[model samples]
Target: MPMLDAIKRHLWSIALFGIASNVLVLAPTIYLLQVYDRVLPSRSLETLSMLMMFMGIALSMMLAVDLVRHRLLSDLGRQLADRLDRLALAARIDTHARRLSRPELATAQDVAALRAFLSGSGVTAFLDMPWLVVYLGLMFLFHWSLGLIAIVSALLLVGLTLLNDRLTENSVRAYTTRQRETDQMAAQISRNAEIVTVLGMNAAMIDAWSARRCVDLDAQVKAGETSSLNRSIGKALRQVIQAVMMGAGAWLVINQFATGGVMLATTILLGKALAPVEQMLGSWKQFTEVRQAWTRLDALYRSSPERRAVELPRPTGRLTVEALAFSSYSATGPRGRMLLKGIQFVLNPGQLLVIVGASASGKSTLLRLLAGLWEPQAGTVRLDGADIAQWPREALGRFLGYVPQDVELFAGTVAANIARDPNPAAADTGAIVRAAQRAYVHETILGLPNGYETEIGESGETLSGGQRQAIALARALYGDPRLVLLDEPNANLDADGERLLNSALLQLKRDCVTVVVVTHRQSVLSIADRVMLMRNGQVDCFGTREQVEAWVKSRARPAAAPQSGEQRREAAAS
Candidate 1:
């Protein structure tokens, strides 16, 4: 509805153009009638000349109407595409964040399909189908038999269209599903190409990918064959009907029921009447695709409805979470157990808190909730005593900085990534440099091929793990955010990178910015003002750094003195 809302204003104008077009369409039939009935008997050159001029003028006007109508539809398609671009992207993000079943599987390609459908001949043909009545009415004026023949022909074609749908509907659905699967597989291979080659999975993956592609191709072939066969039959059927009408017309002429010119004109009228039906049959496949795309787009827009946010002043990083609860969605529905429950905590400005937990102990989940990425089933996450959701989504980056466990960068210059610029050309160069310096990655960046202007490949695949994490740290610290949420910031960092990260955390405290870190490294605990040890989604201990350390020692957990990040993670999980 949102996308169609963009183009609703043009619909009436299109309808007016359609009326003009249909009226002008009578020129050819009337021309033939005049030449045969009036000019041939009178043998008048002047009359013929005037008729020819009139015919040309009528056709010219029709062409002009068609051109304007085409431009209107084209503009509508572009408007729909522009409106859907933002909605699809936001829906994608929300869908992934909510961890819900993606039955709709909406994507940008759906927008392209909708645009193409609106601009393509299929829509014009569809619009023309309704005007078949105009041709039917003209044929009836010529003779009752001619109108009867036209009605039967139209009925047959409509029946074929329905039959086409029934025979190929399943095949079309299969083709759509397989096509999405194939695309997803290709993306997976591209993303994991490094590991696939390193592990000698090229041959196996190629066979698997080929097999999936073949399934898609087979479904496509089945649907296409059915559609093409129906189209061929429909075409043949139209020819037969035209021949029958012609025979009837000649018989009527012989019986003095119609003039020779009238007989010829009935043939032309019948063909004109059937044109839209034939076209609709030919474009049945496209119609199906467009219908599916529209359905998916509609569902996506509904899932993520637009909301108005009430403006509030900048938060001072007073974070609070009381009696929070969250659960994962299983295939059937929400899981029976909560992932995070009874999560109660408060961190004021200038305070630094570190959270340590096992793989599934909900540390990362809690961080996501605190960052307002995920909503809790119960209780609320508040900043400055107001609900986090009160601030508009566009203003989130200014309120908090988040560094997830997986550090993947977009494809752009280093400075653009640091500044988080949606448009790289207008990035804040000075702020970018300061953030990079604060994260202690400026020196490393300078050593790159183009310094801050280097083009990092997709997901920063060109960089090493430690270098990627270092740049991610800079990105998280880019703007003057009031709070920072970090999940395993030092997981992939080297010794120098870890030292720089510690310095950055210390700097945040000096600036009175509340910071919460989830890590498996002992180095962070040394600088932590407070610590929380999570066990089975519950806070097992919460106190000063020494208190949590003593609790870990009493439990005989190896978390107090971690030798390696991986070992610490394994120990905490155990």
Candidate 2:
């Protein structure tokens, strides 16, 4: 209902268009019925020809109007959807600090729902209301009692529609769940493709996932079928009721004829009275479905938590986290469980701080807090003298360049990806080339068929591991931020690739940019000015390379000796 109100507020022009279309369509239907007595009574070739010609003209006009309406509605729908997408994206961008679940994926569905809401429910409401009015008015003009019969049937059909709505509510929920599972299955199958091929278990693995997909799809199909069956049954019942009404009207006219009072044209009017009632019953289901879909889509837009904007606190250089703590509650666990506790750190300009930790040690979460991507549940994060909590997201971004472990690339040329936001001043080609060369991705890109102009394909699928990392670093460097937060920058790099990353970090430090790198690689110990080992959600130790290395090696496992020929062969087979 809120969506309907919003649409009605903006669609005054569309309403006028609808009104014109309704008048054009109804004029012919009404004129023909009113003049039926004169036209039908003649039963001559001349009259028949004239009637056929008029009908043909009316039909052509209706077809032309329908085509025009379709074209206009489609264009309007696309524009409306695009506008809503921009609004949604703006809302997301404004709340950039808040962590979002499946953020990018939600945009597709949200935009699609908006388009369907506009074209189907929006235009239909405007166009159909007038048709309903004219249709009922013609029924009343035919005969008083027959008009009442049509109205009663319409009311009953409306009741059936409401009942069907209640019955189909569960189906919508099931459809959404099934769709999510289907998406997950698709992602998993794609990720496990190489594993399945090497193990020669492709058929078995595929069958397992395919069976799950089929089960989910079957549930969706069953829900659809049930909803369809309910609608079909409701329509059939309405038709039967209309048929009985028509039969009674015919009987009444015959009885009047026996009493020498009935007219042929009057009896014909009874059929006309029932026609619109049948159509109203038929369109009722679509109207209800569309209305429900619109309401569901609108509820999200209205109640979205990201719409709020808070005052931003201004921050200078030297980012700091003082006794910062954050907690994440799992759906399967008790609430209020802490993920990070009393985490304190600082990285000033011209400094390099290395955070070393095992996988899932809440290391990345600490980086996010430092980057101001998230607020701590307790304690404070400060930049210079200002609280990070108050800093504007864009202002904070200007100072920090974060590269996550899993780098993402858009489907575009390497040059476009490197210079993500093209500036009027332009990224100096020499600088870009030097950065690429430092990341060790320069020669790899040049080897591609089109060099820097080559399309990376979806998510940089065409690029190798080292190439992807270098591209991501180049993107981050393009901004020339004062602080760089590298989350496992050497994750996908070989020994030579790691050397390139070290060279780039050294260059950044020389430029007076603060660098914070998270890694578990012992090889990176030589490059750090101060190495901090993070464990159990807090800083375990911070000191010189030898001091941290001694502690790390004390707790670390020794390297395994080389295996014999048979052992090596067995390892290979395994």
Q: In model 1, what are the clashing residue pairs, if there are any?
A: none
What lDDT tens digits, residue by residue, belong to model 1 across residues 385-412? 9888777777877768888887879998
- In model 1, the runs with Cα more than 4 Å from the true position are 1-6, 302-305, 330-333, 554-574
All candidates' TM-scores?
0.94, 0.75
True-structure lDDT of candidate 1? 0.86
Which window of 10 residues has the lowest lDDT sum in candidate 2? 257-266
Task: Name the regions of candidate 2 deviating beyond 4 angstroms.
Answer: 1-6, 23-25, 37-72, 84-134, 196-201, 223-296, 303-317, 329-336, 383-399, 421-431, 437-444, 447-449, 457-463, 543-574
lDDT against true structure, model 2 = 0.66
The per-candidate count of clashes, in order, stands at 0, 2
What lDDT tens digits, residue by residue, belong to model 2 across residues 250-326?
77667662111222333344334434444434444344444545544565346444323564443335767788788
Q: After superposition, how far is residue 114 of candidate 2 from its true place, in Å?
A: 5.4
What are the root-mean-square deviations of the candidates from the true structure over C-alphas? 6.9, 10.0
